[model samples]
Target: MNQFTDKRKGMDHKDLAVEARGLVKVFGDNRAVDGVDLNVRAGSIYGVLGPNGAGKTTTIRMLATLLKADAGSAKIFGYDVAKDAQIVRQLIGVTGQYASVDESLSATENLVIFSRLLGLSRAESKRKAMELLEEFGLTEAARRPLKHFSGGMRRRLDLAASLIAQPPLIFLDEPTTGLDPRTRNQMWDTIRRLVKEGSTVLLTTQYLQEADELADRIAVIDHGRVVAEGTVNDLKESIGTSSLHLSIQNEQSLSKARLIVERVLNVQSAVTAEGGKITAPMADADRVTDLLITLREAGIQLEELSVQKPTLDEVFLSITGQNTASNTQVKKEELA
Candidate 1:
């Protein structure tokens, strides 16, 4: 076997698909990635979340061996990324924000070419191409040139191309950035399936919902550093386990209601911008009953009330203190 093959053999069956420590990358005076560490468990979905220009892509490039790190080290399936890049490349696949497929080629033709380049037999290439096209719900568009495909269709085809070999680890950088809800959900299902079939998915996204839905564990990156890392529940509980939300029937009672909620719950509460609803973190679920009783006794009639676990949006804001959607969009446009 070749030296690269030998390295691959030795690194096989590792429990961590990706292990990165103190990874730093600098572009001139800009330190795009700084002291970031990540550990992605094999066969699980791990999300890297950040706003635009937050080093998410730069960090992925270093881990994928597309870019060298300025400091620290990383390994893919136990093979060092810098010293064993060729072997590491064989064990991982990457799908970026933009499709990498040939625009002039039909979907079937593109996948067939990728399969052939990966060393499948001619008949096997065609079969794999068709199978993947169908699996991605692109059977009808298989014959259409990619230039005519919609953004969502192109994204799906790009992901399908990456899976032709079913590499053990996949890096997805904002795979659903601009996709419609339906297309985004479809991509989510495919990502889940990749993990179910034994591929480790390390995806970077700006969408809170996407990370919350797909990631078993997440690392929240901000200012080119890992600000927080843990399971979804762990991060949510870091701020508060659950939240109390209520809307009062009387507009004037809103102020009174906020006071009662804070006093009874022993936590600060925020009123919505329109001065209609109040929201507070709930430390003890039992305290919810006390708050409700206090509000009613104080002559505040409730319009709506519910206790819900802190959403990933809340978690991100609490950690980074930024509005993800607004900040990401402004920064993304600036980057472009």
Candidate 2:
């Protein structure tokens, strides 16, 4: 047996809705998805985070059965993705960044059409549509064309359509990419409800905050490989427990203050975008008290002081050296 199989020998594979191993896909000599493995527990949100070109979308497509893996194996609910693609189709729903709701159709019309296509009777489809429209807070706008809906409303409608069958597993590819803060929060609430109702989700996004806020477990991918995998706290602890941050009142003393902090703490300092400020990541909070005394004796003239820790954004910048825009462009199209 392979190492992965051996490691999972005694575990319940059914508890994991997604188990992919050594998944590889290439495009024109570019290895879009390298030897990546994923294990997402059922009924939890598993976030795939990376900058652009990080192979997140490509890997997701493979698991969704929209793209075939060039190598390795993937299973959804113990059904092989390649050998049991038809069954896979029945088990999952996909909602991309762009809402797929028809622009010409009203909210009610869109959901009804999808439900009908999924084989619901006319009356059943209409009933399902109304339920979802109200669940998604589109009841008042049910008769409005998708073109008249705001970005967030359209996305909610898109998600509503994907749920026409209430599949066991769902794939959400950046479901809140360009949404406003309030709308993003609304979408987050919907996703949480899905998990509460017993649906497993595989969400891929470039938004670090969204991942931090939602994912039960997270995997950071870069250059087609996973560089880190763990819960939010686990990843933060890997970087550092917490850090001390302060802002200088006097611009002239910034350089002198920075040097004093580095020499006493023996850790590098990061300058934030806010003028006259510096940050240092440290494990012990007690150290901040000592640093304060030393800086006081030196008369650094500090304006602000606080204790903080590393965030997921720092984790991505620390490891990948890029932002969400660094995602992969080498995707395989079924052009043949």
Candidate 3:
């Protein structure tokens, strides 16, 4: 099968993995994650999606024990994040947005060091290092310094380093952000394999399609609040009715079609002059039939017409009143 086709395999969810209730984190005057609740079933991928500074990274950090929470509670494998942090740490692996692998060390050396730090014996560390190298398709370049690795390879090694102990839960923060398309697919496959092996994952990403493709459930956060949360289809349904798009033969016909559709549907309608198109939220499937008849009776010629469900981006925009693409770009610049 081709690489594109290969990346479309099904994902399996098996068990309850991570749970959070009223997860809150504050840094001085800033409340990064405010009253967020999450439940990541075992062996499933749960995605946390938001614009930059949406508390995604802060949430992950608190969950991973890298930062302490000001209030609320989080548990991993039944261990409390605040009190039983060490145990929680042992049960989860984390890969941050940026590659955290040691650039001065070779892939093999990096893995070995991480394994030893996790308490593996010297010989066992070597074994674990080799195992991860092979699993991440990095065996051929195992001895290469991380500085020499390509962006994708470095990401793989960074992920591999996080998995040296094979923790049951993994936190991936924008794991595919900087990789090329092929490498992004490769990383997605790697995540799928981890889930298949009964690992629960809590992923935070800015890519809408990535979450739509991989997450069993998605939570959209804005301004440190979860603005919306549901399965992809559920979220789409919550946004409102499907949009009916019509292509008219001319600008005059476009205005007529909009008036007809608005009268029939009793809803606000938009007409685009550039494409001579009209769009409106359709409440019923029969609305299309009625709309076509109205347009025909009005002597308007439509070149094309179709209905489409709201995409994740649309849902986000509806809830937050901000465009995700522009927000992401702004965040990138701030990070830079």
Candidate 4:
């Protein structure tokens, strides 16, 4: 059995892995994390989704005990972050946005160093290092210096190092941010495996699809506050039951088609920058037949049409009141 698997006895015995209420962090005049509340269930993956500077990282820092909350309280596995920091630290593993591995060390050397520091014997450390490297698909490059590793390779190694002990609760802050599609899929599988092996994951990510795929529940933060929180389906239902997306063959018919859509569906429709795409929320998917007949009568030729559950992208836009535009003017919470 692997070292992590051997140590998994009763790791998921607790019910709540992380609990935070009114978590706040201030940077001078800017309130980085403002009154954020989170309850992460044990042995499940919980996602925190937000655009940049929305305090996702700051809130994570507070929960991980890396930053003291200006106001509010947090606990990991029922141990208070402020009062029982040492104990809390022993129960959680954290992987931040950047890789924390040493640039001069080989992948194997880095993992072995971490395992040894965590009190593993020399032989066990070496064995565990190779095991992790192979799992992360880094065994071929295990002997290469980190300086020579690509960004994705470094990120995978960083996560591998953090899993050497496989603490009960793991805080992954945008762990797959810059990874390519293939590596991201691998990371997703690893995360699922971690939870399956009796670990709870508190993940912070800007990628909505990642949350939709991994999180049992998600909290959407905006302007340092949670604007929405629920399961993916719950959040989608909050906006509408279903979404209608259609495109006309002619650009000239775009405005007329959108008008018919709103008139028939009795809802606001959003126009895309693309040729003739129009999107709208549908409370009753049955109304689409009426919309289609109305459009046909108006001489609109549809190039494509689809009625589907609301996507995470639409949920994010609806909740945040804007697309994921980087606001350089906002007092970024990440500022030192």
Task: Compare the candidates by TM-score and give the number of the best one.
Answer: 4
RMSD values for the candidates in order, in angstroms, are: 7.2, 5.1, 7.4, 7.1
Estimate, for each residue in 1-336, the C-alpha lDDT of model 1 and write its tens digit.
011111122433467899888999877766778899888879899999877778899898899898999999999999999999999988988897778899999999999999999999999999999999999999999999998999999999999999999899999999999999999989999999899999999999986668889998888886678878878766666557777789888898888888888898877676655646787877788988888788778998988888777764555555655444443454432121
Pitting candidate 3 against candidate 4, the one with the higher lDDT is: 4
**What is the descending TM-score order?**
4, 2, 1, 3
Model 4 lDDT per residue over 1-336, tens place: 011111223534357788787888988887878898787889889999887888998898888889999999998889999999989888888888878898998999999999999999999999999999988899999999999998889988988888888799998999999889998998999999999999999999987789889999888887788778778766656557678899889989888888999899887777766555788888787888999898888899999988767654566556654544343244444934
Candidate 1 deviation (Cα RMSD): 7.2
lDDT of each: 0.82, 0.80, 0.77, 0.82
lDDT (10s digit) by residue, model 2, range 1-336: 011112345668879999999999988787888988888899999999876677888898899898999999999999999999999989999887667679999999888889988999999999999999999899999998788899889889899888888989999988998899999999999999999999999898876678878998888877688877778666665446666778988888887888888777766676765475687766566667778888899887788887765654456544444433332243343121
Off by over 4 Å in 2: 1-10, 241-280, 289-309, 317-336
TM for candidate 2 is 0.79
Provide the global lDDT of candidate 4 against the true structure: 0.82
Q: Candidate 4: where are CA atoms >4 Å away?
A: 1-14, 240-278, 282-285, 292-313, 320-336
The residue pairs found clashing in candidate 1 are none
